[model samples]
Target: MMWPSQNARRMWATVATFAAFLGGFLAYLNVEPVAVLFQGQHLQNLFRDVFPPRLAVLWERSGLWWSVVETLAMAFAGTTLGLAFALPAGLAGAANTTPHGGLRAAVRFQLSLERALSSFFILMVLLIAFGLGPFAATVTLALGTLGGFGKLFAESLERVEAAPAEALAALGASRSQQICFAVLPQAAPALITGSLYAFDINLRAAIALGIFGAGGLGAELLLAYNTLRYHDVLALALVSLVLVTAVERVSDFLRQRI
Candidate 1:
């Protein structure tokens, strides 16, 4: 239909432009010959593949149970190691908690230095020193957590209510004593929750790093995919989704309770 009115002509032009843009997208820009992507086949097996999915094949090759355990173990262990360093580092890096400004600055600087270094590079160096396995993954998780969690801890320290801490210090309480009573007690809930979140992140990174023989479900998953075992891929996918969801829910529940 021809639109004689000026407004109608403009509307039709807009529609044309939008249609052209959409069509361009559907007709993808092929950088290579068409045959290269699809192995020069027209893919006529569609109807057969469209039939009911085969769960038996998925079960036979997926290795669902073992991979889930391995992935959870990687996440749990990495997070625990990271939190172990974060607690002490956070305590040491706080200005109010340290007796001397110099000590606080020194520790804070170290935390920054750790954050600046790349975890992948650390894994590489450690792999040479310790060889590939959870040991390398653990070191990477620890150093990475030290920087990230230390910063969070230090910030939390700064944000804690100061009046009680001030009173304790005025009462001739030592720096550590004031921190234990006034600072840590007030901030413990937040600190604990933050560490859990950090652990979750470290767990994901540990899985990814495990690809280079660091030993975890991710390492196994990669092997499955490289071998073209789609069943195992499906299995890894399902298990990973479940574990990640469980961790996230638990972490969220704890954080909300805090």
Candidate 2:
């Protein structure tokens, strides 16, 4: 093993270079240790403030449960709308699906644009146009989902086996026919997986979207935080944690089945 010539030297050199790069980046960012984290009093004060989440407040606040329902609906609708647009856009962007290079490039560029715009910014603009509501949040989530899902779907389409497509071609099958018979079938599992994953992402995004006037648990949490209702904030956070965990389990099960 030691007779590997200069390989060991090269490996050591790479390690040294990586270490230097990391050191330089850390220095540039000026990362500092949290002195407060080491202080017992600070830790105690923080916990004392956040203790005992107010679950009863949820029932006290009329329509709070409905707000949760609205948030879930926003996520579902956004994912559905995003999938609707992503399927066609992804197909057009896929190298194997669309023969024309120019069209593929165009579709890819559009997807890139969609992905580049953050849901936060999109909600800000939509809030001006649509006013404050779940509508803005839904649309914001849809745009983000469109870009992310479209790229993933296109990659899945490109990754499908070429032999089936080739066989279809040999049989004088049309492009659309080949896609329907070969590519779609092969990519269906991936499509479902990606869509489910995107739904999870959209659900998280919907929460953040509430900060910019999109109504949801995020809006309620923000209000509680501003009004010094830490217990309500804690309760909301716990609910979100449970919901996310449930979605994770469901997604994992579905992925395994696929």
Candidate 3:
């Protein structure tokens, strides 16, 4: 029963406070926004170097298409491997399906630790053990997918309607039976949706990992940048944009159907 005027005043106060804080932070960082925006010489040099992407690089560059195929393969392999482990981990982590509270806590904590470690950092560590290649990049993507999808799948399983599970329990179904017949059936749609989302995320991560010498389109991009082939870099960036956009579109379509 607060007055609308009071709500408006509160909103305005919050906005003013945020603006003041942001302004203070920028000042502390010595950020001269207007000066940066008006850096005409630097901006002009950048534009001149990068304009007119080399469209022919899409086909002209030897092994460019092979790299694209390698990227797709990495994403697919990583997602499949991660989700294979994630399903069981999710079953163990979920509140309703977990065998015990201790097991659930352990599983969830492991997942959190995995998520806390960035994929790039993990990839760096893995490169030492596995050596730099698509294999290392693929493993990094798999671990990332496992961490993210496990948590999401656990939450999805936990959110499944309880009535069906309870009914199965009352009919003297075992814990495993209840989970398999009741909980999983209801949670299937959410799990499928999460899997698709995980694939989308891992595809982007694979590209980024390749930049660190993981060997794919990202490696190509890094090489172009290091060689000062700005035109080629721009063309590679366009290819990445198209690949991500296509996957996103397909993922959206699948999610809608689910």
* Model 2: CA > 4 A from native: 1-31, 255-258
**In terms of lDDT, which candidate is strongest?**
3
Model 3 C-alpha lDDT per residue in residues 4-77, reported as the tens digit of each score: 99999999999999999999998999997778879657788888999899988898899998998899899999
- Give the per-residue Cα lDDT of candidate 1 at 252: 88
lDDT (10s digit) by residue, model 1, range 165-204: 8899899998788888999998888788887798678767
- Score residue 94 of candidate 2 by CA lDDT: 97
Model 3 misplacement above 4 A? 1-12
Poorest lDDT segment (10 consecutive residues) of candidate 1: 46-55
- Candidate 2: worst-modelled 10 consecutive residues by lDDT: 31-40
Q: Give the worst 10-residue stretch by lDDT in candidate 3.
A: 32-41
Residue 226 in model 1: shift from native, Å? 1.9
What TM-score would candidate 2 get against the native?
0.86
Instruction: Give the TM-scores of the predictions, in the order they appear.
Output: 0.72, 0.86, 0.92
- Score each candidate by Cα lDDT: 0.74, 0.86, 0.92
Checking candidate 1 for backbone clashes, the offending pairs are none
